[model samples]
Target: MRLPRSLVGWFYVSPLMLVLIPFFVLPMVVIITASVLEGDGFGGIMPFFTTQNYIDVFGSGLTFNLYFSTIKFTILTWVFSLIIGFWVAYFLVFHVKNQLLAIGLFLVCTVPFWTSNIIRMISWIPLLGKEGLVNMILQGLGIIDKPLEFLLFSDFAVVVAYVHQLTIFMIVPIFNSMARIDKRVVEAALDAGASRFDIMRYIIVPLSKSGMALGSIFVVSIVMGDFFVVRVMSGGGSASVVAALYEDISVLQYPPAAANAVVLVLVVMLMIGLILRTVDIRREIAR
Candidate 1:
């Protein structure tokens, strides 16, 4: 009694639907419902439905500033992570001759994740702060008489934290994609007189697009949804959409917080959709 192909396909997809329903769909539905309801000003929601929450979010100039700050961080983090991750993966896959040593080095990069992220972020202060190692070293080198105030508790620190934490996301996917490439193809290209640069540009890069897209999706989603890192790293000097949402929640403004959350989810979905249109990540990952 063999099952039909469609039935097998449905069975495979059923588990995914189960997870999505409980975790993703239900939460989004609750948020949407909350976004439309009126807040009772006492940390509770009223039964009445209203659009005022969204109206308030849309009307505020601070909303624009929040999103702008978030987008700026998102772009910067994505660019730096992609560049560093891609090259590091490339080096591991191509340059390192010993497989054991290559994997050991790769695992070394992941040592940061063993500790709490808050601990890691705080640890940077001793190395990047005004009187930290960086300032001491520079002063010893006669580079400057004053410490670099912008190194910590600023935009630079925020970006450094983001890249440090999230570059692993990019590296993993890109490494997977690059690892599956057939070295025979490179040998063939070389046998045909193709230079290393030509092979990389024409063959390696084109084939790695799917991995790049997947990595981009992960980087964008994490950075866009984060509030804590931006808040702590920036010393409250910067703000994000989620940070604004957090502020509303702290004040017991449930409706406004829900509205902000819904908008951010929609925008993130649109960005992911755009990335998916360029590559079939599901098939690529399966391969």
Candidate 2:
């Protein structure tokens, strides 16, 4: 006996739904419900529904600053990651003479991920801090009169840490996409008197849009949802939306935190929607 096609489709999808319903759907529903509810000025929530939480979110001046800072870091991280990742992937896929060596180098790049993220970030402090290796080197070389205060616990350090952590996200997807390209197509273009720049512009970039979009989603979502990185790296000097939510939760302001979370989800969804419009990810993956 054969199942109906729609039924067969559902069979394949059921396992995903099992995970999504309990973890994704239920949590989102709870958050949405909590966002409109009142907080009891303690660790518990009240049953009363109100829009004041959202009102507070929009009305506060700090919200604007938090968003601005987060967005600034996100853009910087994205641009740097894309540039470095694309070049690295291009070189590994196209220029590297020995495939084994290229794979080894790629693995070397990913060695940092083997350690905990907190450990990796903490390690950077010793390299970037006032009394850190970088400062000592510069001082020894007489390159500076004193340690640069802005190198470690400032916006610069935050951006550096973000780029360091997120570049791998950009690289993996792009490498996969580029590796899938038919080398014959590139050779054909080359034979047609096409410049390397033209091939990259018209062929590589267009083909890799899907990978870039996927990588962008990962970077944006992680950065937007992160509180600890900004808090720890910036040393209380900068903030993000999630960091603000963390502060609210610490103060027993559940409704406000929930409201902030809801708005952030909406914003992220909007950004992802815009990105999806540029590429048919399913079709690309199938190809």
Per-residue CA lDDT of candidate 2, range 1-287, in tens? 99999999999999999999999999999999999998888978899989999999899998888889888888888889889988988898889979899889888888887778887777799999999999999999999989999999898889888888988998888888988989899999999999999999999998888889888888888887888889999999999999888888889898889999999999889878888899898888788
- Lowest summed lDDT window (length 10), candidate 1: 108-117
- Per-residue CA lDDT of model 1 for 93-191, tens digit only, reads 888979899889888877776778888888898999999999999999999999999999899999999999889888888888888889899999999
For model 1, the stretches where C-alpha displacement exceeds 4 angstroms are 1-19
lDDT value for candidate 2?
0.89
Best by lDDT: 1
**Pairs with steric clashes in candidate 1:** none
RMSD per prediction, one decimal? 1.7, 1.2
